[model samples]
Target: MIHLLMEAKKGRLRHEDEKTSENDTGFATVEESALGKSIGKMELTHDLITAQALVFFLAGFDTASTLLSFLTYELALNPDIQTKLQAEVDEAAKAGVSYEEILKMKYLDQVVSEALRKYPGGFILVRQCVKDYKIEAERDNEKDIIVEKDCLVTIPVSGIHRDPNYFPDPERFDPDRFSDENKEKIVSGSYMPFGSGPRNCIGSRFALLEAKVLIVSLMSRFDIVPVKRTTVPITLAKSVNLTVKDGFWLGFKNRNR
Candidate 1:
């Protein structure tokens, strides 16, 4: 992932250099061709570009690490699910697996989704109020609850996912919670694995697909089993951004034909 980021940075620099050369050689012209408006743009500073690159790199790394942790925990607890996933992968491909082929594994997709739901990396979504607003009182006799500007609002993802009100018997590891018919019953803001709105993670699709591919390739040939010293109810690390607790440990046994 770091190497990929470096490559992207190099490509961006090359493109900027080519743009500069074009401007110098009169190959490119800046014209005001808009809706009767002129907009001025400034070149991004080196520090700003570097910061942006670091943010993206960290985001990708954190997301990938969290996903791997989730998969590890699930595989450790449910050996049968692991075997079933492996069978799905074997049935999906004749020879080695391809990216397109991994996409077609519906059961694998559900497993990944269930992992995300069970242990979302970001357990809380936080936001600050931009303007003052008033919410209706819970009881008919009470006054409205006023929320002043700049008040911090925290949406507890872990709590929401475990809430029996939204999800019936939420503690169970049931991927069918997201099945077609049942999924429609999920409340709007309650099921935000990648968050919602335009500000949500843009690379969710890529991240999910990559996870599927990695797991398919892994489970196709090996069975993951729990090793000693690993805790049963996965403990979470306090310092990290994701849900990873003590590092997940597992043993790999190659499947015999």
Candidate 2:
């Protein structure tokens, strides 16, 4: 990947004499965009540009794959939900599949939202304390815990998502939880599948679009079903990223058949 990026960078650099058509609004390559740019008085270099490209590639690829895997698993197990989602897909197909049409898919959005809630790519969020902070005891007899500056704090995102307080019967895969009416009732900070604040996932919009597009394309032609090898309750592997123990085993039945 690094070699390919370097070759692309060279090509872009050599194309200084190329003329674009009037209709073409050519975009700058990562290397071109960062070359000679100043940030905090530090000029960007080729190394930094390549590193950033690598980060974008890896982060987007792994997280999106994980999300799609979990989504298919859920669909295979929940045929009712799969049928409902496929109905939406069929309706959309009549008008043709496009970015604009995908955005207007309410049920599709709800289904994807529920999948993320169940299996968030990032199960934990970590942050460093810039200053001392105090947390008051929740119970009368409990002692307060003081977090010193420079301390690292980890938020259990998966735990919060599965907590019954925020989402009743959290383990169940129900897209209605994200329906227009019920979605509004969810508390802020209770759901952070893509983290929160300004430092949230940069490729969130792209990631969601990719998932929607893939799901639409997949469901339009085939039905996701469980085969003999499929696991009823998915066993997650112990790893930094969420993944099935033996990977996802799903059968795709052709809709036309």
Q: Distance (Å) between predicted and true CA of 216, model 2?
A: 0.3
Please report the candidate that would top lDDT against the real structure.
2
Per residue, candidate 1 scores C-alpha lDDT tens digits across 1-257 of 34444554455422222233221211001222242133333355567667877787678778877887778678868877777777888888775677666655667766777777777766788888889999988998999988899999888987887789988887777766766576677787776677655446655766776677678767877788888966788666776476545677778878896
After aligning candidate 2 to the native by TM-score, how far in Å is the CA of 195 from where it should be? 1.0
Off by over 4 Å in 1: 1-46, 243-245
lDDT, candidate 1, at 69: 72
lDDT of 1: 0.68
TM-score of each: 0.77, 0.82
Q: Note each model's CA RMSD in angstroms.
A: 10.0, 7.8
Which segments of candidate 2 are over 4 A away from where they belong? 1-42
* Per-residue accuracy of model 2 over 50-144 as CA lDDT, tens digit each: 78778988999999999999999999999999999999999988899887788778888889889888898888999888899999899999999
Q: How much lDDT does candidate 2 score?
A: 0.81
Residue 90 lDDT (model 1) = 84
The models' CA-based lDDT, in order, is 0.68, 0.81
TM-score, structure 2 vs. true: 0.82
